[model samples]
Target: MSTEVKDGLRISVLSSGSTGNVTYIESPHERLLIDAGLSGKRIEKLMGDIDRSLTDVNALLVTHEHTDHRKAVGILARRYEQLDVYANQGTWDAMAPRIGKVDLAQKHLFAPDTVQTFGDIDVESFSVSHDAAEPQFYAIHYEGKTFVILTDTGYVSEHVEGVIKNADAYLLECNHDVEMLRMGDYSWPLKQRILGDKGHLSNEEGADVLMDVLGNRTKRIYLGHRSLHNNMQSLCHLTVASMMENQDFGVGHDFELLDTQPEQATPLVTL
Candidate 1:
């Protein structure tokens, strides 16, 4: 409800959908961008909307090499003097050719399934089920507060569920409605890909995963990466909220159920 950004960990979803995806996070000593999917100019404007300076970003973390997630990886790295780009060896190998040329010094690598500290933030990466060179889900820790980013994955793994418990906040994917996708305008092969194990998570699947990981400390739950064609924002939110209600968890009381847009940034929330 408050527009001012307070003390703990602060975050905003700049945009989240099939078109493009980006998230901005700030710790006491560092400012990080989880993905640089949008254009550099667009990203700058979105950060300005939240009163954050994109030029002050210290690092850019790439989740996978998809166009919607890594489109601006090289652009932002080139534009910001202090920004360093980080990805795993496999992701780097798959994305290097697509993101254009980044300076050698600005390129960094971190192993998956390990916790690495950058400035004041500690980022722990885990493998997820997706069709990429190496996809990751991050749990970032700062001053006792945790912010987890879980999107672009087809399914949540047991190991991921174990590591992501008791997070202060999350930007989870509620990508589509299964019935809608099955009857949408996409071709047979495209529809199959979306429904496959390596594709995106549907609304029901996302709810199923949340039921396993929701905890008392989870205050903000953002339903992100919804399909513009196959899923409506109201439907996606209601689907998850209803499922949680059955488990005795009340939306807006136990935790806030937030919505993200493809064209604008969500409210900047501090946990």
Candidate 2:
């Protein structure tokens, strides 16, 4: 058997979109799943396809209680037995009923703005504006590298931007095209919710945040949590790229830009 020593952090977007959202992060000392949105079997298959094992996951960090983000949280926790699930108390309480039973020992609570170390990786939860009890965006630190998993929030507060500034990589959301969302068949209330302060970020909004924070250390940016119904991957990519270019940020030179799909896993990005 060929032996390869795995070091540093490896990240992959298992799936991302309105249907479901999940991300796999493998630090040198711990394996983490940002959200267990898809069915347990589907998550397992995705992990397997990426040459990783679901049963080896060390933790499941749920951002919020939304069905699209917590569908398999409980099932995976039960099946794995060893997986430690982390979420804020508000999220745990709101999601517990829908996710089914998770042992008291297995459930862990993390407060916003607190940095908790699991093995060699340090995970910090930062408050985010979302229509949930308490949603958070994660900034993961390992071996001097930082990777931010940012999505599902309508806007990023100045404090959050300061905290996540100059990360090595980012899985940021570019959810929808505002025009498509406005002109689509969805009801007015739903469209309003998406465009509101507590809804998903549009391409313009997400790009604005990236333009402000990306720096010398920033390397890879994976645009995620896109709206399958209202956003085309090509359009989302072009929009973000065009905006960044306007600010003198050249794609593939300043940083590598990639899109995460709802049904497929992004290529494993190792930092």
Candidate 3:
């Protein structure tokens, strides 16, 4: 299959949830994986299904030290001799032992506040509220277009809103339905952790953040990292769409709305 990227930018969510999380982002000159939570073999298979190749990936950028987000980091880096795995110093220090031994040359560290250039794509990492060592979301700029990945965040701070405002597209988290989570079977401590300041975003909270950042320039929004039990795809879509509609924004016309599943790759999106 041809690996050529069309138009401005191409994005695909390889998987997104508690089980595993990875997102593919590419510019004309470079390809990147946002996270490598699944086994390396599985991630490669997912990429193959979308007519892309893991061999073509230039780097892997990790969000934090969570096992579900860095499960295959070491394996992939070892397999792909030239691949560099990027993360903050804290995340690297916290996740290194868990991911096993990666080649010394393959570990690349970036400060949260600085912009790192990868070929024609420029990546900027920003702080997020999560229980990891130092979790962050990323914004990519290429060909004058912006694509932001904002998931695994407990709450969107004012600074985060400003960083992602008016982006061309977004992969935002819609982690759970608060009511469902509250009444569900999870242990009280687990429930509290999921709802706390360092936990995931609920449908309502996700909608509010989108409402604050989305603008005319916004073209597509993918709801990501949905809980298997606490959130349903249809429910997440409905809740966020309704919120947008109430704010006088036409869901389909103003911007495309989609959801990412933990076991499937999303349709390749080009912008």
Candidate 3 per-residue lDDT over residues 170-199, each given as its tens digit = 999999999999999999999999999999
Ten consecutive residues with minimal summed lDDT in candidate 2? 1-10
Candidate 3: segments with Cα more than 4 A from true spot: none
Backbone clash count, each prediction separately: 0, 0, 0
Per-residue lDDT over 190-271 for candidate 2, one digit per residue giving the tens place of the 0 to 100 score:
9999999999999989999999998899989999899988899999999999999988897889789998888699878787
Instruction: Identify the superior model by lDDT, candidate 1 or candidate 2.
Output: 2
Which residue pairs show backbone clashes in model 2?
A: none
Model 1 scores a C-alpha lDDT of 0.88
Model 1 C-alpha lDDT per residue in residues 2-78, reported as the tens digit of each score: 23435678889999998899999887678889988889899989998988887778899999999989999998888
By lDDT: ranked, best first: 3, 2, 1
lDDT of 3 at 234: 96
Give the CA lDDT, 0 to 100, for residue 54 in model 3: 81
* C-alpha positional error of residue 150 in candidate 1 after TM-score superposition, expressed in Å: 0.7
